[model samples]
Target chain A: MNYTLHEQEFTQQVADLIQQTACILPEDIERALVSARALEASDNVAYSVLDTILKNVDVARKQQQPLCQDTGLPVFYVHYPCGISTRIITRCIQDAVVQATADGFLRPNAVNPLTNKNSGNNLGIMIPCFHFMEWDKPEIQVACMLKGGGSENMSIQYSLPDAKLSAGRDLNGVAVCVIDAVIKAQGNGCAPGIIGVGIGGDRVTGMQSAKKQLFRLLEDENEYPELDKLEKSLLAQLNKLEIGPMGLGGKTTVLGVKIGMVHRIPASYFVSVAYMCWACRREVMSYKL
Target chain B: MNKKIEMKTKHIQLPMNKINTRKLKLGDKVLISGIIVTSRDMAHRWMMEEKSDIIRPYLKDGAIYHCGPIMVRDGEKWICRAAGPTTSIREERYQSNIIQEYGIRCVIGKGGMGKRTAQALRTFSAVYLSAVGGAAVIYANSVQSVKAVYQLDAFGVPEAMWVLQVKDFPAIVTMDANGNSLHEDIEKKSIQNANQNQ
Candidate 1:
């Protein structure tokens, strides 16, 4: 017999998940911000900015208000055991999104590209994008991230072996491309940002993998030794850029760096960078079927 | 090159004059009081296309905020749940015109504006202030009242123009009337550092 999920109960859980995720700054992100704050001098502009950010996190959690007005595009990743209907799960998530929007946990972010009209309920085609996978586990696992538009605008992709950057198809070229993206993003990406780097995949997969890296905890080390070293080196080099918090200049430009790799076709060499702001609102939940 | 920028806090009243705006310098922290109007992407376009007369009175010598607040209704009154600045660069196309035409003395938002907007601030004797990017609740707490709203029905909540009365709303001057822009300075220095490292 296949395990089943109670429809209404599951929907309510997802709604609760949205509320919790939107209002609470994840512990890892909050800790990273606290550590970053200590790096700056007390009287510096960067210190004040970090101070306000820490206070904002506290106020949002205490008052049950959203961490950001943009609440962002709700992207969900779900994994379920075999025989559980993906259709039902998607519908439940969609319903929960509407309930959350009406409750003010999320803003009306979905809009029609051609008409320039907002759906006004955070629902549109491909709105609240979903990725589903079948796993061996008996329970369902879901993770959601509220990615704001400012940071989304800063995400970039690059083709290696480029003459302009003097970048080859090697890791050195990847480093150069990543630094270039950071320079171009400046404070625009809401600096003291977190960066997710994806290497050696085709364009779309590279970008997708890069975004997936953001779901990792700030303190988690890369499984691959080379990538771990690369992450550490990039973090140090980015802070050295002195873009600081909001690009006003300080010692800390980024709080964390996560990198992932995938195999690519020989014809193409794509490097994708996903820049996440300090807010970094993401959460994970597990449900027993 | 970690140069420490010392900041001093000042409380400012609305409908400010050129002298006050010009007097403010980069890196000064400010707590603003009185009325300010929220205008995002759609509102900016409407202001330029229709030349909104309804909001002009409130904006002249007043402030324009690049924000889209999340609002919830309690009985008959509207309560702002989360209110933080959005990126100001998206409004660059209409911002210079809006600043000049509306006599806007201050522009508030996050992720600083571009060279064109900075030039307008210099020419018009205004300032660009940046709030923390994700500090929505802190900003919403400063709201004394929801004074009025425009284009709510037509433009939807996020894109609507909300006139709010606030007290002690905090921000920092990143761009001043003297053509000094911390954003531009930081960008230039960072690029130089990147090139030299290469």
Candidate 2:
């Protein structure tokens, strides 16, 4: 009646996944950081900070500990196979998060927005946020991202035909807006950052699609040729901004750029940029159903 | 606040007085050694509201780190597991007031704050230091002792007041009392660079 793994076992696996996602920095992110460091000037403070970051990454791994104190809110983008209960999966994920928090693998980061209270167990209203998508494959694929607050606060959305920046209703307009977002953020989004851009959706989905890009591998190319070109161009342009690592002023401001698109109403053109810190913590795990 | 202490290069000897902090320029690399109190949004609010005479003694002449660290209890004692600077801009509205209220000499955080806080630093004879964002693991190693903590039930763990004794804690003087700000300079220059790149 259930998937290949028992429900309890499935829950345990998800907990381990959260723990791994929290503690381990992905290889692609590590590579990008090292390359960014290489690009910085010898005298720049960005170089020294990057050196310390690399060392910090090493220590977190050797100790098998969380990379940052603010381990971040766990976001699960689930590609569930047919016949699985959504309620069951959600409950199991919440249980896993609580387990991780108790074990010290995750900080108690979740808080009640209205009351300013935290459950101390990483469980609150819609905490361990999930994005579910049905898939043809029998096995379940769960891609988890730890969205930290600092960069999340910097996530932005802009309407097309904006007059202030001379932005219009085209891809060029999107480029200007995206670059503008990066520029305003300066070192505040915890640069150097990975920008996940969403174009052509309503305000909500526009932001959602942008966050979805964070789930992609850092080095992976976009599926669409045009989006790919945009990613390449933006990545090149953002670095030239020279915001550098920790905003200390250097040659590297962005490690990667990912963009996703969706159909939108004729009247609206929304572009959302989701700024992700260089820690860029995420992991995708699969199990047979 | 002077004993004519020997200076350690790359480290800011703490319990920082005006003389020592004023000496630090923008982008000066230093590791801090001394007691620093940790407080975030609500703690800042409470400090302003309560302004308790009891705590002012501890806060004066000490650093306020804009961080919400992960701490676990080891029996009666607490241990800092992972402590890194949170974005200081969120506290921008309240930081200046807190600084002026208490004779706070230094502020340690990341992603440098705004104009009001910068002006306040100049007015009050203080400086803003930046700890490396995402440098939690190493920052944790720098926390030599957890002297005390307060207000857990009301504010929660991340929002609690953690009084920490740190040694060789790493940070940079991103905002100096001399009215210089690295973030502002970078923002200005980056806008110019963006125009040129286009």
Candidate 3:
């Protein structure tokens, strides 16, 4: 499969994608919020919280403004044809991020860890992180998620078979870890959040898998039966906590829970949880040339 | 725990007096009007160090917002594009001092602060309001104008201090001056629920 990748044209398209991604809350996420609101009593504070969140979504889309003050770090997952050069793709996405920031579609969120200096633009070392994979498809498929710092802070990882949690290297232990993380997070991650769990990989890979699971649609069913059961059970148990919206008491604590698994070595069993706030801004674009 | 209790709504004016702040209770809804000074991690640190006279007037009997708004310039004036509360817990260290020294009556942000800040709220007659997190455009719509800004050049836009005049900006009283915190209550309840589930 041979193709010509036009650099300038691609950059502008990616910029457009970033702008749309920043402003629009995806439908599935919006739907989940509406349903979550229905679960709460009309007089409950949680209902008011969800009502405000839904209204915010509408205003942001109409005004074409960034959904949150912290426009967050732009993360991309690109699937391209075998012949497409990933280097060109990376450069184009980087340029798109800079363009989007200038246009006020995104806030300049990239900061230097060592010196605590912001680049003033959304461009810095590994700022808009990218993951590229070559596939048999002819078109280039790019999906972007704007992950905010508030929820990012809530993301946690745990090594199993611990004495404290009494969580062994089993599914029961995995449930314990996930429950504990949500309890600790409370309303900080912007409750009625979406939970993405990664089990069995090394520490770093485990986190990566958990974040990637966020891309899965809230309504989508897991292919694996055991994992699906765990997802359903955890979702029920978490809502029972009644952390509600913004950690204020109500009914809905999590909108959905997604779990993904990978192969692991005999010695270590790691579980990583990535908590996404209700905003959950993600968009996908397929360019067929 | 009857969930049927009606939540009261109040319209609050900024540069609020201690009497007005003390009347607020947990779970009450608030619509704030008047001027609010925006400060984040950097601006809070700067307030501690400089205590600049320029900002002191705004803080006295006023509200301090934990926000990093996205602002755009149209001609000479600054337009607030998206302004939502950041997590308030980040400011737990500097918040108590800022409230006491500046005579701040209200603290607005999401994710309630720690025990120290709660104690200060009781001592100083201040309430902690939780604005909806990620509701940036809704917040931006309430801003009538940007009166002034500090450290725009040094701190950049998001981290800069924005003094904004607003009308009817909505929030909930998650932590009140009477030493009640919805955050702490919810956390304890959730822990009990977790135990029961296990």
Candidate 4:
């Protein structure tokens, strides 16, 4: 089988994606910000904080600077066609990250956990982490997520039966767990955030689901009506906590709530919540080359 | 009513008022019209290792900041290159000792330190202030002047001590010397509230 590699085309697409990630604040995130401001209490300190954050985003975008100082660790999820070579796809991503860092489009945030020595190129061990999902189609789809440490530190996984008994199971149970985590997180995770909930899977799978759901647009109406309703309910419940922006007393604690679920064993269901800060940076690119 | 207390370090004397940790909420920006210094892991370590008088001039009634900032030199003057706050958790090992040894009145950084530091805060009538994390540029604007850089040539930008003169720098009172800590209180209350509601 003869395989054609269009290096220029691939390079251009990845570069454009990186630029888009750097310059543009996703529409869903923008809407969430507006929603947070509107839902915030009038006398709340978070109101001003949220306003400052929104203003910062504007300044960063206008100035072509990073939305947040922590450009974050680049994580890539690739859906490759069965015929495509995994090695080639991985190499392409590595190349893209190198080019992006050199161009100053992305900051190099990868560092050794123990030694604290930075890779300086964002290409350290297990970095630009790739997770492959095989698809039957002929084209590859790459979703890139720049996961910041602030919110990423707040990710949690609960064993269903145990958490359910402790916190009470059901949608409200999930909401309470999430809100509790965020509040306990205080300003550490950076607030005016989004929460991604993954229900009904094993531990690791649930975590992955929650993380993957973060890539979805905040305004994306859920395909499953029940999940859609639950998302809205969770968002409302979380906002009512008055954790507000940046954990100061206010109304809008969470910008949006997204729930993704799958079938699980009859005995147990796992739940995971992943938080993403206002500086959510992600992009998706579909390429033929 | 705001209760006022005087914090003295070396030569610097700071008159600060006791504010409720709950009320001293995050993002409630305030003009911190008090004495604060820029100190972090390396500076703290140097202070301990040498027991040096290098910090004596600045330790007077001043607060120490835990930061490893990026700096650049222009001719004779040094400027902050990317002076962002490092995680405070890293300094849990040295903060308490440094605070008591130096008679430091306050510590500033993003995220709060551990229990020992909190205990030191209570024992010494000191406080820990949480500066807005990731707002390095915003914090930089508040810096009025750079007084001096200690151990400059040997240590890199992040590790050196660059003494600064700042005015009305914004900070949230996270831990107070009176055995009160906003971070601790919030975590306890939040967890309790969560358990009850559950």
Q: Top model by DockQ, which number?
A: 3
Computed on C-alphas against the true complex, the DockQ of each candidate is 0.61, 0.50, 0.63, 0.18
A1-289, model 2: which lDDT tens digit per residue? Answer: 4565477988889999988887788998999898887876655688778988898999988886778888888899888887887788888889888898887778898788899898899887778789899888887788889877888988999988899989998889999999999988887778889999999899999999999898788789899998899899999999898888888788889898999999989999999999999888899889788
For residue A257, model 3's alpha carbon misses the true position, in angstroms, by 0.6
lDDT of 3 by residue, B65-180 (tens): 99999888899999999999999999999999999989999999999999999999999999999999999999999999999999987788889999999999999999999999
Task: Give candidate 3's error at residue A253 in angstroms.
Answer: 0.4
Query: Of models 1 and 4, which has the larger lDDT?
Result: 1
Of the true interface contacts, each candidate retains a share of: 0.79, 0.69, 0.81, 0.08
Summarize candidate 1's per-residue lDDT along B41-131 as a digit string, tens digits. 9999999999979999999999999999999999889999999889999999999999999999999998788889989999998999998
After superposition, which runs of candidate 2 have C-alpha atoms over 4 Å from their true positions?
A1-5, B1-8
Q: Tens-digit lDDT track for model 4 on A1-289?
A: 3346676677667767876676466877877777777765544445556665666566556655455545567888888766678888788878888877766566666666676565666788888889999876667788878766767877777765464346556765666667666765665666667888898788878888888888888878887898899888777666555555555546666778888987777876678889887667888888863
- Which ten-residue region of model 1 chain B has the weakest summed lDDT? B1-10
Model 1 lDDT tens row, A1-289: 4897999998999999999999999999899888889998887789899988999999999989999988788999999999999999999999999999999999999888887788988999989899898999898888999988889999999988888999899888889988988898887778888999999888888998999999999889999998899899989898889999877899889989899999989988888999999889899999998
Global fold similarity of model 2 (TM-score)? 0.96
TM-score for the first chain in candidate 1 comes to: 0.98
Cα-based TM-score, every candidate? 0.97, 0.96, 0.97, 0.76
Error (Å) of candidate 1 at residue A166 is 1.3
Docking class of 4: incorrect
Q: Where is model 1 more than 4 Å wrong at Cα? A: B1-7
Stretches of candidate 3 off by over 4 Å are B1-7
TM-score of 3: 0.97
